[model samples]
Target: MLNKYPLWKNILILVVLAIGFVYALPNVFPDDYAVQITGARSGTEISQQTVDRASEALEEAGIAIKGIDREERSALIRVTSSDDQLEARPIVQQALGEEFLVALNMAESTPEWLQAAGAGPMKLGLDLRGGVHFLLEVDMETAVEQRLEATSSQIKRELREERIRYLGGDLSDGNNIELSFRSEGDRSEAFDIIRDRYDEFLLDESTEGENYLLNLSLSEQEIQQIQDYAIEQNLTTIRNRVNELGVAEPLVQRQGADRIIVELPGVQDTAQAKRVLGATANLEFRLAARQDAPRASTESYPFRDEPERTARLEREVIVTGENVSNANQGFDENGMPQVNITMDGVGGDLMTRATRNAVGRGMAVLFIEFRTEMEQEVVDGQVITREERVEETSIISLATIQSTLGSSFRITGLDSIHEASELALLLRAGALAAPMYFVQERTIGPSLGQQNIDAGFMSVVVGFILVLVFMAVFYRAFGLVANVALTLNLMLLLACMSIISATLTLPGIAGIVLTVGMAVDANVLIFERIREELREGVSPQLAINAGYSRAFVSIVDANITTFLVAIILFAMGSGPVKGFAVTLSIGILTSLFTALVVSRAMVNAIYGGRKVESLSIGGKLANV
Candidate 1:
């Protein structure tokens, strides 16, 4: 009775193993290489016409598509191979146009029953799924300058509200704003206003002959905060874009002081990925310039639809894309495409104040875009190619203030439905705080990913077999029980990962291999302990119980330490290392359960409660 487990205990073990097997079953069903097509904006449905167009495009290209399935909002076109998947996406995109987003993805092929129970396959990392990895360098200087410009605009507004007239204020030396006033009183008042209201800025006043100068520069702490905010905002914006792309297990994290890393696993179309990730389009609402407005206070931009024509708008912004809470694309009463915009509470108040006094005045929506271009410059006699950020502004819409606008309003004048949809998508996802350029990009094809999968699988299989052989030969019957528990350990590990949707990379597979060895070591320790107990002239049942009872502490201690290390790695490491750490952490837990509990149960069933002299642990040590 010493080594015997209670009925409920055995039942609980069986139930756990059953659940593990159920959850881990989905991984056996591989995903289908497919192209997913969805509306660029919400409320657009997948119609039969769209499906026909996609099918026709694939057929004309001679790319064999397995089938087409249309859901309520999207359609999936399963292809025969990865080549077809890659080639079919562009063809479909060209056929469907910009109104629809055609993305290369892996379609789930799990059985309906398993899917119904919420069982999903473990997500593969970019290295295993063949996607795009991008290293983007953010323009931190541009971010700071943008902040300064906003601060300058706020200061100008504040001075005007206080009836303090300043000649002009300009962002000087890219670090601070310098204001020139005609009188010392105006400069002194402005300095006090800025210093009192904006604690982040360092205000200094100087007398330049007759002109009074007031300079406002951000404090070091404030600058650092701005930089941190820019990076955090960019990461969030990039994540939103990646989600819109419908990527699975995408990685978007800060790389360093001024860089970001994005890994889009299961996304084969790098062009689409790059376009979405690097897009820096934002919207600005400004009142149209009056006929007598000063040139210095107004800026001109060409129309997005009619570039030959230009419109001038006030330099002050009423609200920006950051205020947009939601946007949806729809058709106006005139049957032309339009975007319905919703603003946050703060934005709504600002819009109401800006529109209340200028009911009939026209307001222009400015679309600002930042693009990165390569320029060659001779630096130290070497021609170095550098990326230059170019800013382009265009007026997308100009309409009279229809009564008084509020949190919810509609913008018309979009050229096409596709343009309207794209604009709505951009606005809905929010805007990037600053422009980012891709400094490095790596594309992994599905074939290469398959190769990695094959290699990883082979390594696991080989390592597993070797561990099994060593365990079986060294300890005979107890080793066989360990092997059975080892198999269950793997199942439980996979189940845990799948349940949590963990991304498995090549290094993660390495962790699994390491887990196998550690599991075997645990069993080896217990078997050796049993051998020692038998040498001390203990009975088989007592030796078995003592071996397990004594080994539990060591197993728990060792696994706990390893689990701690894995937690630290996951916390401090990036994509690959994190993937490895996640698996190792999970494996440590599953291995502990199997090595101590499952193997003990099996050993108890094999040798417990009966009159036995020795365990079938090989060598003279077992001959007690």
Candidate 2:
């Protein structure tokens, strides 16, 4: 009974190994290359008819497909090969027309039972899975212009509140606001008001004949602050959009002053990622312009639901999407699609102030989308292609103000529930502070990803085999026990990673390799101790007990230190570093369990409750 384990303890060990094996089994089922189709707009949906048409198109094009899996609003066409998938994407897109979005994807072949049990393979990193990478440049100039326009509107409201009169005011030189007054005193008064109220602006007064003009330019500090805010906000927005796309282990970070890098792992096609990440869709709430209002103070935009009908809205914006804190898609009392919006304190206050006295007036919600276009301009006989930012504004909804709106409201008149859902998603993700242009885009093919995976797999296998061979050759019987523990350590490590949904990168594989060596080192120390005890003419069972007991402290000390380092790395690092840290951390735990518990159990079962005159430990104890 010296080295025998309790029945419950043995049962627990067996149960744990069974669970590890069960969870890690999903990794054996490889993903299939597939084409995914979704609606291009909210009004569009992926119907069974659409899937059949796409399937027919693929057959007509002689592209082989394994099967088609249909969902509520999307469908996945699993193809036979990656090459076929690539060729089938465009064909499916053409067959679905512009109403649907077609992109390359991977469909999991995991059985429903495994998935139902919450067991799945580890997610691969971008470098291992071959996804899309985008380098986007922020339109800082346009950001400045938008800031200037908002500032001009604020200044107009401020001057009006102060009872100051001006003939007209307009944005001048793209960075300055010029306001013309009828008298010098009025200009002087306006200058004092602006200088005292707005620290971000530098006010200058000038005269042209009988007209008195006051100019306001943004301060350098304020301009820098705006640019910084724009970059930071765009980073946050892009991250939200990437999450909305359900991309696993995405990287969204700032690179330079006016650039951002977005990496979507498992996103083979850039179309959907680009459309969501780069979209500058925003909302602006403005009061409907009165018929007698000056034309210069109002702008006309076509209705989104009916492009033929136009609505006039005041140029003064009450609030924009930046004020939106949360949004959800829901149906109104009339069963029409609507978006329930929640605003921040500032936006709520602005809405309250704007609508407090205009109860009967109409408020319009403007949907603004900024799109990038290429323009060729001839300058001095050289035709230069330049990127242009095109602004498209439409009135999504116009409703009479029944009461003063507060922190929460609803916007209706959407074309479909899908449209409402998409709008809600975008608004919930927050608006980009500035438009982003794709400066570069690259797709890492699955072939390259497979190569990386093969290389990493080879490394792990080579390291594992070498460790196994060394342990078995040197320690003999005990070394073979350690080898079994090492193999179990790997299975448990992978199980932990898969359970936690950790992304596995190249560094992660390196961590696994390291874990294999460290695992055997524990067994080596115990086996060597056992040899020393046996050389002193001690009984084999007693030596085994003493070896394991004495080595536990050192094993704990070493693994504890390594685990702390992994925690720090995970806390401070991003992307690949985090991936490495996660695997190392999990490996440390699983290695400790295998080295201390599993190996001990195995050693006890092999040599427990039996008298042994000699052991098979190598070196001087080969026949001890």
Candidate 3:
């Protein structure tokens, strides 16, 4: 009764093993080299016909096809190899046209039944899958300056609304928003405005001869808060953009106060990765030039959607991009392409006040982009790599305000629905609170990834075989049973990992190897206990039951402590360490299950019901 499993316990153990087997079956099938087709912009969807066309294009190119699928806003086509996938990109692109994006990728070929059962292969990490990694530094100065400019613009408008006069647009000199007023009354009013509405700022007022000078700046605490928010917002925005790249597993997170780290697994092209993830663009709402005001356009003052046209607008900005809370692409009442924009509280308040008395006056939505291009430079007789930040601005829409606009507004005059959709995507992703340039870029080649995989796999296989042989030879029949349980434990671990879509890195592989050894450790403890009981002249039934019962404490104590360590590691670590912690944790749990539940069930089946005078666990002498 001690080591023997009841019918329900037996069923439970068998059921868990069966579930593990079911889930782990998917990994047997190999993934296919694939090409992904999607709109270059976010909102563009791929149709079934598009998938068919892609398949046809592959066929016309004399490329072998495996399968195809129509996804939410994208499509995928499967091929036989990476070479085929690379070859098929241009062919598929030509068929889909220039606007549609074609990217080479990998598609899992797990069977439908397996997928329906929530079974899939483990997600590979960047090192395992050969991808791009970038370290980006946020331009904190730009962020602070932009905030100052917006504050200056808002103050200028607020004063105008209150009938308080200020000389020229409020100027920002890095540290302060300098406001010069003609009267002491105006300066006092500005200080009151700063206190009441802009409580985050500190105001300093002085007399510059006949004029009252007020310098407004954010408090130290406020500046620190802004910098922190800028980093976090940039994290969210970068994640949104990288996801749009259709990456299977991406890491986009803040590294420090002003830096972010981006890791994309299975992304092959460096140029495409940089373009999609690193390209910086945002929007600005400015008042258009009036008839009485001088309207001038230069070649540089161009429209983004329609570059042939030039943007003519006043110098003052109404709203910078940070306050955009949401954006969606849709047709207007008259069925014109437009992007509906929604603002946060500050932007809403600013827009309402800025346009309150300016109805019938034109407003321009200008798209600003900072593009980073790497170029070689000669410095001190040495060739060095340098990044050039080229700034470009274009007006996408100019419309007269029919009503006083608040947080929610729309930008019309887009050339096509595609342009509107892209604009909406830009707004939805939000403008970068700060400009970012890649400080470090690394590309892991596919060959090296494959080599890592081979080495990791070989280590696991070799460890498994060594453990298997030892268990079989030392424990004899009982050793073989432990080995069986050990194998099933591995299966369960992999199944759990797949179910969670966990990313497996090299450290994860090392965790699995560690699990393999520790898994058998549990069995060794139990087997030794049984041998000790046999030497004490107990019947085989009594020995088996007592061994399992008594060994349970040691197994639980050892595994639980290790599991706790894994939890701590997972909580405190990042990247590869976290992956290692994940596998170790899961492995500990699975190993315990195999030792207590599975190994016990096996021993009970073999020697539980009937009493025996002897046992054959690679040990001989038992009294008859």
Candidate 4:
């Protein structure tokens, strides 16, 4: 039989299995781990004393702290624990303060043998281990408005540069623009110029009286496309930022037409996660109110803007967050924790100019508003009486400016160390579209996760035993061979999943069970064919070869269709559906190998080059 087919036939199976195992080898190892500790309360900083205290506390709790290092505002501690004695959050938080972050089971921490073998802790899905999940809706309306504004600005700039004679028009409103030409012919020519030159920018256009109204509204289909593109871009940016934070298996993907879902499992600091996910770091450097400017004369101002007074003040933004180079947590001159920021070349020049002009005057105030639905309602209700009340203000000092701002600005006055750190992280993560409010939240304790793991393992064990027993009793010798192959197939599948960092959920386990049954079906098909050939008085080798050849096409066709369905599910599904698809796809591939190649190899080893009167056991003609 081996001599009859192409040598590449067996080699293809070998290569695939080799690739899968090679990819999976890394999942079999242990990992290195570290713990970061910091002060939780406001105005508190981590020092050597803090580190010493934490070490003592851990030691008292029967946890042996091996090495400890204290930086300016935080500490890094290293320790080891048995698999059953993993560190608990309460004990660590009580000792190191609520700001402490612990990272355990790192791949690099495993022993050399285990590390090389790709063994480590099991990966948990977001549903099992509570973390942060974000559903961000892209503001397509705002995007279109911005595009219109940009188009208007470009037109103004180009006309000015070209010295075109035209009347000024209101471009900010987007719906209408008036440009009185020098003559009727010039008006027509100007309209043609804009309509032809800026076709891509214009959504729709019409002439009303002497003005051309460019309808800047995007179509529904166009808006949907833009939303998708934005979601993809945001996903890439978020993925990169999360990777920089050294997180493992962070899932970032588009959830719907305009929303994206980000899941970060094992992220305990909800505040920190929110900061990273919500910051739209749209920094702006506007001139401060001058010292000689008239004061409000009272602590509170009316909600409605006093246009006569407010519009008289001169204000302009010199730069924005786009010019920022980097931001990090640091300390002010008074030894208070602050965010250290740096700017790029253009931003540094702009900042220097702005600072030089405002040195003797009041410092620039930073406005940070976390707008949620409730906040919006409150602001809107007071719009007629106290519109200004909606704005929140925090002031930084010249000393803080000098220490923390170097071609950049630090936003201080944070209520706590965690808050300050989170602010820094937000700046570092880049700006978000807008502040996100929690619509729903949930947390799963590690204890519950452990319980779930135990239940899932028990189910798999029981199912495996039942299937093995059933196969052996029903098909006799052939059943025994199939069962062994099935067992090995499971090990290989798990090894492959771990290697690829594919998550395993409960639904994924169901996929594995289904694959098991399907694998048996394939073997049953081949075995029954071989039995038929044997009853026709064919030799053992010829019967086996004919059976496999006849059943191969059917097994391939069935599994291929299933594989296609799994792929479709992966493309359109989320969360558990995705996990199910991943496991199903992997299982199908493994089943094909185990049912065809592995079982065949075992049979060849047992009955190769041997004459047999009958391929049956227990004299029942071996129900195949």
Candidate 5:
């Protein structure tokens, strides 16, 4: 049993280790300075000509070229060094102009084939890579207001459908909807209608001086639920937005009750990030009023992109961007930039009913932005500052409906291809449930990230060397075997992380250090068990066999408990805490394998068939 690693077992172990070793090799290669050029607008495809143009521009600038690769979405130009990268970026941007977005990127030094096999280095987290960090505070007040507006629309629809005449409802007293009825009979009728159809609102009857008023407000529980949903939905929406930005690893999670923290790694263009992540924009398809209406800047709404003009749009929304399941930037029949939209079943039904009788009428694509503005007012001889959320709307495009469209449609009137792409991206990312403002913003540069890497690497090396030396001095030959196992365990951990594409943060590094201790601890348990057996005057071979068998259960139990804790931490923790839990979990797993399977296999292979003798651990002892 001491020499139990048969041909098949040995073969399996070798195969796994070899695979791990191969996958972990990419880390040895350094990143190269490169520039990536992607199409800035729809229908602006990059061909060989663009690549050639980029090459010529860089060559003219006297920059050394490493290679040029055409990717599915973008073209990459690899440069010789960082200096060459600095020289090539501006020149390429100039050649491409506004039609293409040129950004600094890092290409791996590993061969392309290895990368093609889906084996690349693990992604580094924001702390390790040093990018953008934003702490966003969700506007709870705006969330409630938005919900109230939605409720108001629903009430109007129901009242009109039931043929109950009433004055339009208004949001009064901060959170309640006050609906005025000229007659008591109509007020009672409306009460029954709302009570039967809507349980979300708590109704109250009151008299506003002389007019009959029905007060409608959401219950406390409903309001709290809506607020919670708003934060959760915004978290999901922000995650989608971050992904659309092509950031490799972004951290978007809820913080406290009404806040979110977003970390974007390896991002250089903060402006673009802000545009895609910060904008609270949506699309609305509405029927345009042909007659010109008087414009009021204070109470009236303005057009989306055109701020100077006003849009007298109907309050009833035909359909919203929320119903859009998919959107892509493309070109129309006349080569105009447009977004091809596909709607969900609900949206499709709404559109069909809306346009059935409205053919030949004008349909306007209105852009809406939920913005917050601050105003100062004097009350009772004292001035107080107030912040107000403005629902800004604009008619981006007004087109005559050619036919009754349902399910799918195209929106035109985008001024540029860039605008089309951006609008499409926003629609596809979905609308935020609540408005948010930046509470804190930070940017970490690549230089700082490199410094963190250097410092972290040095710490690991120092810790590993000290452990390696301690094991060697204490356990001698067996210590050497433990060291070999420790080294392989690390390689396996990294290989596993690369295979899973785990994000390695600073806390993850601490996990690796924790793994080093656990690996050595396992060996120490077995070695101590063997010493106890030897003190009883057992034969060396018997002691060795007993040492492993007796210690195996203990190792499994201890590691199992720790593994369970890691799972809990990972499930509940966020950001760097989760990162640490991930590496620690992987470490516990690999340590068990190395201590029980790997180290034993190596030890038995070396001294199993030879004359039985004492372990080199304690110097001189004879065989039984």
Candidate 6:
């Protein structure tokens, strides 16, 4: 039976298929592609009057305060303003700082098409997202000193618990302890009494004249072990904090034995990141000075108001940050910003005991120290005081004792909306470990990104038009069919890209250009075969069928090899290179299907089972 179909009918079917694919495009994009409005910082130190004044100033400058969240030590104000103006940043900073410390958190606005397009969620890189990166160098000397102090404390605690009474130098000072013996016989008895007790920690010992000298030096292997443990501990602390940031993919790894590298891709404020990362997390709970202590004792306390004194009273920490299990930003009873914190089981027990004992006494103060630069002139001609600013430590809080130090508590001293917000975020994110500091920073303007997009579009348009012209001019009517197939091929490619939500880079445009050239090659092969068959006196229908069937194998083989190469490139590539590979692979697949299936279907329908006398292969047969 001879089956026939109209040429227009086949063309209509092809057009419908292309439109259907394009319509399905939005389904492939992600649903939750918009940027989220993450919460802000707060504090108690800031007066309400100052906040109102700052708000008025911002309004006067045309900046809108979108939202406000308060914390113990600061306030977080979500503001709508231009992020890139050099003049705007300083104006905002000065206006806010006049009454409170402010930290700005800025992120790119969400694209409007994100929801409509249903594209996958956008993942921002470190460069575009602005966050903190740190390379921490561990202080081995400090670690060694800490170990020595711990060893001494342990020895004293054990002796006191055992009720041992032997006169010797103090272990706390790392000096020789000479036992006071009643006689030579008592000396031998005292030596035997402590020998077995100190066996585990004792190093090599020898008699030095009238006393036995016991060495306590740690071995090289022990020191190395201590260093390794410190590095691991630091890494663990950093990982915990980064995880708390709610970031999608953060890079945290050990660079070497004593260093670590941390990368936070979408962090908006580098200063806050630095604060979190630079915190030592070394928490301590210390008893406040007794009111009955002598005036002489008070004078010796490091913090003194004396003009001649350089040292000040060092506010001792009662509980350290290590015991904290969770931290969150929240409002206190009066709507002030405060960081709510919970401690682990052991820490809870210790805190409970400490608070119970100190409940009626002076409140335990939380002291937070951070390094900053300050300029000072020589007070006297003889003294060499500051020209270039140097690092100085400043206290962050002086909260009144309202409740006992316990398992749960809040820290509040927020001066402005922004300061409070950042601290809350940092605490929730986890206090970052020390040694991580920024080495480089950069920011890209959106204008530049837009310009790149425009240039890329023009290049692709020019290249595609040139390919379309060459194909149509060289192959006449047959070339027109090829061009239609080529157009469909590009449409399908775009549909697939939209479906996958792949980011298109400049190199990806080049891949698309290459695909256009390759798509025409398949049609040229089939057309030349048809011309050859026609010259030999075969009917147009038979020549077309023979041409398609013979050319199919070669076209499939060539495309399959190229497809494999693209896949390999994608697997091994990163960033833009992977983008190029993805577009190129999509192009190869779409071109093959359109050039073979689509073009052949159209030609078959046009000729049907009837024989034609003349068939145009576009221009000259050689042009094919």
* Alpha carbon lDDT at 63, candidate 5: 87
* Candidate lDDT values, in order: 0.86, 0.87, 0.82, 0.59, 0.82, 0.57
Q: Lowest summed-lDDT stretch of 10 residues in model 4?
A: 297-306
Per-residue lDDT over 165-258 for candidate 1, one digit per residue giving the tens place of the 0 to 100 score:
9988988995889999999888888878888898898888887888899988888888888889988988988888877777666789898899
Tell me each candidate's TM-score.
Answer: 0.77, 0.93, 0.80, 0.60, 0.76, 0.51
Q: Show model 4 residue runs off by greater than 4 Å.
A: 1-52, 61-88, 97-110, 117-122, 135-261, 269-272, 283-431, 435-441, 616-624
**lDDT for model 1, on a 0 to 1 scale?**
0.86
Task: Note the clash tally of each candidate.
Answer: 0, 2, 1, 20, 4, 57
On lDDT, the leading prediction is: 2
| lDDT by residue for model 2 (1-624), tens | 888899899999999999999899899888888998987764556788899999999999999889889987778999988789889988988888888888878888989999999999989999888899889888898888888887788888888988999988888985789999999888988988888888788888888889999988887888899999999998998888788888778899999799999888888756566556767677789999999999988899999878999988998999998899999999989899999999999999989989998899999988888877888989999999998778888998898898999989998878788788878888889988877777788888776787899999999999888888888898888788889999999999988898988999888889888888888888888888888888887877788888899989998998899999999999999999999899998998998899989988987787787776677778775233
Could you tell me the TM-score of candidate 6?
A: 0.51
When sorted by lDDT, best at the front, the candidate numbers are 2, 1, 3, 5, 4, 6
Query: Could you tell me the TM-score of candidate 2?
Result: 0.93
Clashing residue pairs found in predicted model 5: 302-393, 303-393, 303-394, 304-394
Over 4 Å off, model 6 = 1-84, 91-140, 143-269, 275-624
Q: Candidate 6: lDDT of 126?
A: 44
TM-score of 3: 0.80
For residues 1-624, could you state the per-residue lDDT of candidate 4 as single tens digits?
Answer: 341334575577567666555545554453323355544432346777777766777777777765565676555566664232256334666766556544332223334564566654446665544355666555555545434444555565456656666655344443333454444554555566677786443444456666544443435655456556555655655665676555545777766666666777655454445545543223344445554555541122111112122211223345544455777887768777777777789778766755664555433424343333333334655643321212232332212234223375675554555556755654565544322334444444444544665677688788889889988887788789999889878877887787677877778878878878888889888888887877777776777888888999999999999999999999999778888899899999989989988888767666665665556422234222
The positional error of residue 310 in candidate 1, measured at the CA in angstroms, is 10
Candidate 2, run of 10 with poorest lDDT: 615-624
Ranking by TM-score: 2, 3, 1, 5, 4, 6
Q: Please name the candidate that would achieve the greatest TM-score relative to the true structure.
A: 2
Query: Could you tell me how far off, in angstroms, the CA of residue 552 lies in candidate 4 after the best superposition?
Result: 1.2
- Please state the error at residue 585 of candidate 6 in Å: 8.4
Q: Can you list the residue pairs that collide in candidate 2?
A: 614-624, 615-624
The lowest-lDDT stretch of 10 consecutive residues in candidate 1 is 268-277
Kindly list the per-residue Cα lDDT of model 3 for residues 233-306, writing each as its tens digit: 88888888876666755778777678999999878555557655777666788887766674432123587656
